[model samples]
Target: MPVFFRKIISPSLSPNTESDDVWEAVRAFLKPRSWQRGSAIDEIEHWFKDYYDASAAVSFDSGRSALYAILEAFGIGLGDDVLVQAFTCVAVPNSIRWAGATPVYVDIDKRFNIDPKDLEKKITKQSKAIIVQHTFGIPAAMDAILTIARKHNLIVIEDCAHSLGATYHNRTVGSLGDAAFFSFGRDKVLSSVWGGMAIISQKSPPKADQPMAEKVKSPPAGEAGQKLRQIQEKLPYPSRIWIVQQLFHPIAFAVILPLYNLIIGKVILECLKRLGLLSKPVNDQELRGEKPLFMPRRYPNALARLLMRQLVKLKRYTIKRRRTVAYYQEVFQSRNEIIMPKSIPGGVYLRFPILVQNQEEVMMRAKRAGILLGNWYTSVIDPVQVNRENVGYIAGSCPKAEIYARHIINLPTLISEDEARRVVAMV
Candidate 1:
């Protein structure tokens, strides 16, 4: 008999009382000109402020936009340098460049966050800010980071893109920084399809006085359909794995998967897009290259309402993720082949990342067993296949980050403890 593995992660799509209430709220709010000043966006801002204990909150079209806005709000542009972790998503560097500031890469520590020692060493007179990313929701050493930033008078902006609901030393991740940003993209802890929030602390520097652009129309219906399709695509992992296993040869598996993904998957998705069954995914060019002064329109009302519903059950979701992390911890504790990051005081585990030798082979075996593992930050900066030099990254500049990039693979936080253990046993 063949074994079938369950999905590693699945978006929370089940509806409840709160979801029903949200739909009713949206329906009532949809009346002609019902959404005025104190509406969905304001409600979300208030929710974030109360939840994170933040003084001020702002929403944006995307998390990258939130970071850009924060950088611009503090006037960190043109000739300024912002230090970021070398092992973060490419969007971090892109946001810095979008603000007309240079991004200086800093190496990561055992916790996979920016190394405070390395961060201090990289500071120059040109260094205006530090974007401390909590990689995979593992909180960085805030005490050390803050000490260095205070001594150097550098702005501290926490990239809570992966760290929503995460904490550092009993304090929420967003509240500890001068300013912070959260992403609500597809895979985020509190996804609203595609949205972001910025929390401005009381001690944050004076923000720009310019008002943001007016609200635009809601996101296209096709966008929701596209997200649905994306979820559907991940559902057939067993079949995908079986197909790959049948190929036998590594070269054939490598060549065929890409070709199938590029040619067959692309054509089907494009057809769906043309039929209005799905929307075309946003490409890198579309996301990047906005002017330094460019300000995106406000978050949509419908999405804000959707996000508010998710917030109602955020605690439950976080608890489940924590349980999964603990399961992985227990299983991998005695295994010398796998290395887990040191536990932070109050960190939330977004994805249970582990370092192993022969990561490619491990991942291939996991896939062949119908396991869906997370291949996050496979490169120093993500989209690993892209040339590092093109993104201003120099090879060997951050050796530790490069090594981690090569060895890291993440376990799903959305599965049950039993499922997690099964994944470990298979590995």
Candidate 2:
């Protein structure tokens, strides 16, 4: 086997030159407004409704922020309990806490998403909401979750941060819940540097639950507007080459990321630099506020402009991801040692996460083969950790999630057909 991980087939924008034109338009609009306009923000919001057919979208600084906003919007706080998947990223429970609510860790099924059965068991009078996450772009049992939510009249907050273009039974993931949150980070389905969005419910959003005016604002258009235009004017150049290099250069990445973190680790220097506290670390004290400090850094202004231009290409990427996932399912079906993800009719595969046994051993093997596998959530770090529940969200509780978390290895599905086959062989 080669000592290099197979490269992902990029489904990003074409002409890579259009980013220039898009940025030019952005620049022209922001000059008179002194970068105070929200049109760029509106473009992102409209994309949800126009492209994904979402009801309404509110842009935020990050996916985590959107998650917190949704919880606050639902009036989930102080002694209230929100059921969350123990297998999801820390951001899930952290959002629950941000709302001044406690998060009850629930087990997950083989799909790596919250188990509907487990969800039903965890509900109580204090329960005010359920945070449904579509783990690894794989849609959870939305029908079952919706049924349970309806029976209990519980608020549903779909974490579409990982399932952007993904749908469950023809309906978009965000629309399935009472409200939804999406991530538009560098690694997400859609890239907008470091921004995120909150998709409000199709019905009425719970006004009593929304953030207080003290914390809410019209949401500034920010500096992104001005920079977007400047980048557009320079788009005709070959900028994607850098993108390709990063995706393909394993050695450079290993060296570069560590160096970047080292420079950022200096608290004194960062503070002196006037790095805003909000920009420094995630605030974990808020129970519906920020917790578990890990936020993706904002992409360079140039990159954001590039992403804006390339947003349309997401459709093609979605198709390739879906097809690649199908191929893996077919080939891996006969392997009893692994549990493959189920098909979600028309959804795109943001990532292809599979369950297995002896994950450490599997990971070691894959690593030796130059396959860089991702451990979506290594531990359930929230609600319990913060609540001082020393018992923590144990492994055996959600056997399926634990199995996937431990033994499951995520293979790249956003690769060319040939690359997909090679990855399967490595598995």
Candidate 3:
């Protein structure tokens, strides 16, 4: 009875719990001076290294910060343009802008990632980075994106915010790019509740000069955030945590954040000059930008940290989602107006996107039946002029993406197979 689609999916609901191995690790982390010794950070870093097979992993206050941090490390800044898919969450463009750079929107392929052909055409002298996003848990076309990045000498930043355990061509999404970010937020495949991890490719670090990550000092001057982190570090992962996580976000945005916005807001929220109860925003410059907040707050962090401990169950969750997607694919495969994306052998289903003729009507009907859907992406990020002239092209450009976006209803692949069958019947 929480608001269905209006309510964001809480990743905590998945059956992830801390194992004895992880519990022992956390016990060690909670010892005195744990912060200074870097034991806790090291545990997380090593987890990332082992899980993602990356050379180095760094944790930031949140995922968006990780994105901007990597951008800064790579020397991307003002006068540089990063091509991004227009249909992504606001965070994608905000990440580019936060790094003292601009975002040049591009169209996507039918799969909801950067269209390789379009990406090749967008390259210019000022172009510096290409952010390839795995939208809604579907892996982007990494092979093509990598080929283009290599030809242009552009830095590739893979936004694995959606697809954490997903793979492309037998390689994990996080390991395929030069650098990548993973969000362990409420609705993600992995729920750290509110945290993010950035992995530097095994080939090299962001640049020669900067150290991977600065050591986070203990007794963290920010009393509120530190307390929250402490509590999170102690709690065991729980499915019920999703209830609290789902209830808190809109409240935080509406009530708590506003209070921060009024006084000492800049320092506490953005600069972390003195962390109040919130997570650190990217930089002082981020506060000055035209976007909204991009970091986690008290509740998300507590739940997220607890959720990270739940990741031992990822393989199980991925399997369930795949089974659900498989059923939907069978039902909709022959429907002319709709498109059901095929799951590649290595790829797992994040959300099964389907194209339909009357998206609006399908959404209404699906909602009436307790089914929820998404616009995997709304539109490709092509520039305004191109968007207008290509309006017709946009119409057919990502036929599958557009069809999926327009009529594609994302049912809860999170539930049982019976629920998936019911969803198909109702749709």
Highest TM-score, which number? 1
TM-score of 3: 0.68
Best by lDDT: 1
Regions of model 2 farther than 4 Å from truth: 1-38, 51-55, 205-307, 381-397
Per TM-score, what order, best first? 1, 2, 3
> Candidate 2's residue-wise lDDT over 65-122, tens digit each?
6677656555567878888888766666666665678888888886778899989998
- Write the residue-wise lDDT of candidate 1 on 139-244 in tens digits: 9999999888777767788999888888787888888867889987656776555578877776544223323331111122233223322322332121222212
List the candidate 3 regions with Cα displacement exceeding 4 Å. Answer: 1-41, 205-304, 379-405
How many residue pairs clash in each candidate at the backbone level? 0, 20, 8
The local distance difference test score of model 3 is 0.57
Per-model lDDT: 0.67, 0.59, 0.57
Which residue pairs does candidate 1 place in steric collision?
Answer: none
Q: Select the stronger candidate by TM-score from 1 and 3.
A: 1
Tens digit per residue, CA lDDT, model 3, 95-158: 6776778777676677766788888887787888788888768888888788777666677788
Superposed by TM-score, candidate 1 places the C-alpha of residue 145 at a distance from the truth, in angstroms, of 0.5
Over 4 Å off in model 1, which ranges?
1-38, 204-282, 286-295
For each candidate in turn, give its C-alpha RMSD to the true structure in angstroms. Answer: 11.7, 9.9, 11.6
